[model samples]
Target: MFAGIEEVDWASMKHAYGPADDVPALLRGLASADPAERERALDGMYGAVHHQGDVYPCTLACIPFLFELVADPWVPDRGDIVELLTSIGGIDLGSDDEDEIDEDEAEGAANYAMAAAAVSAGAGVFFGLLADEDPGVRLSAPLALAALHDDPARVLALLRARLAAERDEEVRLALVEAAGRLALRHRPLAGPVADWFARLVGDPGPPGLRLAALAQLARCAPHALPGDVVPVVTGLLGQLRTSAAGPGSTRARPVEPPGQGAEAAPLTLRGQLRALSAEETAGRAAPWTADLLRTLHAGLDDRVAERVALLADQLRSPDPWQRVDAVRMSDRLIGGRRGSYAELVRLVGEQLAAPEPRLAESAAQLLAGLSGLAAPAADALAERVAADPADWVRTWPDGRTRLGSAATALARLGDPRVLPALTAALGHPLVPSELGPGVARLGEAALPLAGALRQRLSEAVLDERAYDRVGPVLVALAALRAGAAAPEVLRVLRGAPDAGGERLRTAALRALAAFGPAAGCAVPELRALVRRTGTVEAAEAAGALWAV
Candidate 1:
């Protein structure tokens, strides 16, 4: 079946690395006995061939081989190969949603469809995998079918049938979602598909499953939904509170098992590929309601304001799980649209001062993500950061994360009054995650704080946390063209973690390079870095020296 692999002019084809000569070896590596080697080969293939999902022409060239690989049960990570084929074949295009929506064509939808044609042309394998003995393979089959530009509806019946036969909860969840996306894109199937989802919502084994169905139902057929939206949401929230609080997995790194949210083992390949982001993946080890919470928020199209209000109420719920879900909803509701919610911002902003440490921290983080849309709550966020307990400096659980969250929110608000607080935060030995980015957002406008930033660079401690403090400040200072920072940055880079770790070294070198010839004083240390290590840091150091 792979005879064609050698027949092609492989040398001439371009992958991410400019030539496809290495493609055949990587493909063979998929079946390697060594898991580590196979993992490396897979990573290499994705990086060089798909290259952050920019499918090259050579990507299409490998389609037939992938189809063959997916059909062979002997191939390890066969589900991953199927998913790879699906991603290569599928385009992220706008739904066939006829509703007046202000949405764009899925980013690179055209390129995606064009790349996916190679796999769709071999649609027979995908359709066959829907009933494969391995549940992992079966899960990916429907997703692959969803990529079908031409016979999308052809897989609808197959998915529904599999959903009934499928005993594994994760596989069933993917099938239902695939069905929803297909129904949305292939408008003709909406009525029947919507009815299927509606049926699942009321008659359910688990509340998460039902909530997932309702979310999809609302999305694919908003007008077809029943009148009692709020009550259904209320029940789902109750179920979530129960789920999240139930004895979560005790493992250091937990992977949720199929059908059960209470505990997790190590994740399967199928588990990692789903829509939820990596950050959301960890919570799964806990009895996670995050997926449903995210889906419900994402699915609400009609009565959106009412749903948002309901979500806000739940954010203030006494149950920790309900509150966690609500906090997540606040971030999701904004969805980058300034016009979407006035009340959401107000409520979440107020939550920034909530007595519960978790709620206040989550609220601050959410506000930072909302940017200028969260401007109205800037005053409250600023006050919270200002009122950070004096004892927080040494014993804070996350060092400066909580304080930084509030300061970051103020920076995003683009309010000038945020400068004093931000400058103080930046000068602290433990800077918060993304606080430097918030500072960078202020750009050259932060030039006024250049003197203090330089002083902080010189005086800051070089503890493990020092990297976070100095790295972002270095980047921000460079962005602000604070050439005066070169000397202090040079000192930190030559020093150890006790002076600031590799993070500061890397950032300082990059900052020096940003200064061009203005960083002349650091030439000796930069040359030594190139000579001693010759790693990525070496390259950065060499570049800095050249610029100097």
Candidate 2:
């Protein structure tokens, strides 16, 4: 179908990388009979060519070939190809309006402007895909055309008409979201579209359609929505608040930050901000209720206090999902400045003692993160640490990702009660996270756990499997400036090379040498290690010698 695939001067055009020469090779790999090969090709192409919606010239040129591939009947995983086109065309939905972006985001605003301009140039390809025969292709069309076109009457009529005949619930959801996104771009038609969404929302039809319409209203034309919108959304959230996962469920509640997941590529700081939206939660396979709650909160921006009140209600909900949604919402509302809204902080503080274990766990994690915010909840966290240990489900690890653990939270709250809990957790066989960092976050407050941390440090010397925990443990000791533990640090420095790998040895050296000249005893070993070490360990070893 691609007539000149080989003849295209892809080398002249730039993609995410410096040259677009690799683009054709990856695209050809997409046609491989092996499923794994095709998946890898798609992933590599996505990361390099259309990373975080930054559309390079090579990306634009590849659009027609993608369309041809999607239309090919014998193509393996046609659905995925169609989805890729939809993602590519999503650059079309990007807005160039500078006012919508933060003033500090000169780069973000500029990136969006470039992507939108480039994608909008190829508007005709998306508009024509509206009547594609495949169900997946048909569903993707409206979203692709959304912000790419400004003709309110034309796009709305097309989407609204498509929705009437659309039988698939998933496709119907996409259509409504697309219509809302389009309305956001074109304000002239927002009032009518808002009226349409409000009607769809209140209709006693399929719950999914109603929920989709509600989410769309939250995105665009929120002002034009009906007066009874709140009740309609509230009722939907109640329906979706079932405490347990549904049938055909793995029951795994993945806590990911939008598209900032580990899958596509490592995101730059600005890419993270640009990817934030209701789409992450709303379109997920489960937790539709959380999605609605987040969307409702997004549309109710007219009053911050009111938004907090709504979230506070969820925080107190008996249903675990509602409470989880509340935690997620609070993270968005009162970020670092927990003092800005003392009332919100106080109300949130109450959740640290919530009867529901998950709610209390997430709340503890939230307060632990904010400097001094946890102080208001110190007493409550103390109560948590005093209680018998419960089985807590860990969503993710602590570093490079936002993870939650009651033990981690208590450790960071700086309450003396955390000392005993940290001691017990260190002995537990299945502890959620390394207790050391949370102890380190407590800084000098962690002195009580010094003995336990040392015990674990000694265990690391005996157990090879315990070596990974060595770094965080050393960090805690260094933070305490526990000169008394210098002997243990020296042991790790001596044993790490023979017992553990390069990483363990480096961490041990860092811990022993982090303090001042009190560590002079280790100076000889530090100098010898510096000579044999790779770049990273050499840096650590040099610092250790300087400390001595």
**Candidate 2 lDDT, 11-122, residue by residue in tens:** 8977666788988877877776655556567766777887766666677677777767765656665556656665665543344565665764655445445545655555
lDDT score, candidate 1, position 421:
71
Candidate 2 whole-model C-alpha lDDT, 0 to 1? 0.64
Number of clashing residue pairs, candidate 2? 0
Residue 111 in candidate 1, Cα distance off native in Å: 8.0
516: Cα error in model 1, Å: 36
Instruction: State candidate 2's TM-score.
Output: 0.62
Per-candidate TM equals: 0.62, 0.62
lDDT of 2 at 508: 72
Instruction: Look at candidate 1 and give me any clashing residue pairs.
Output: 89-116, 255-264, 255-265, 462-499
Shift of residue 121 alpha carbon in model 2, Å? 6.3
What is the C-alpha RMSD, rounded to one decimal, of candidate 1?
11.7
Report lDDT (Cα) of residue 73, candidate 1: 76
At residue 236, give the lDDT of candidate 1. Answer: 71
